[model samples]
Target: MTRSAGLSEAAVTSLLAGDSVALEGEHELTHRFTTELLTTHRISDTTYNHALQALGRDEVIDPVHVIAMYAAQAAMLNAFDIPAPETNLPA
Candidate 1:
């Protein structure tokens, strides 16, 4: 989906592989924030600081909101025993 949105295949692959150095612009910040959010359940001070330095407050907030919303949706789906559809995209 990200690549279809215009990111290069290399960018998508780098993100999936957890290689932040290969990402650029908002993609880099979002990747860092998402990792912190998923692993810590909250953005850490270091991640928050880096985001503030690289993006505006709203930019930082947007990805956090997106991640949280999707996480909540996934939790609800799992609670109801709903299986996510398989995608043909590379893992």
Candidate 2:
């Protein structure tokens, strides 16, 4: 996470506080990326929500699986060509 952002130690505090626009931007990107990931992995909404649970702490957080799942979902969405975003409940 640290290396990916190209942030120095001094910049970490800002990232943690989300003082930097790019850090907050990462959050938004992550949300969308994770959303697509879950959909593609066939991971149920309930499972995804559970992963968010501090207690559950899913073993999988890597973008490969998450992004693949989401990309699959995106493909489905693209087939439909809908502009609207689907709201989901916690798994």
TM-scores for all predictions: 0.78, 0.29
What are the per-residue Cα lDDT tens digits for candidate 1 across 27-65? 777777888799889888988988888887888878888
lDDT of 2 by residue, 1-91 (tens): 6646565654565556645444434443444445555557455566456555522344346654657776678788889996766655222
Backbone clashes per model, in order?
A: 0, 7
Show the lowest summed lDDT stretch of 10 residues, model 2. Answer: 51-60
For candidate 1, report its TM-score.
Answer: 0.78
Report the alpha-carbon TM-score of model 2 versus the true structure: 0.29
Report each candidate's C-alpha RMSD, comma-separated, in the order given.
2.3, 12.9
Off by over 4 Å in 1: 4-6, 16-21
Residue 3, candidate 2: Cα error in Å is 20
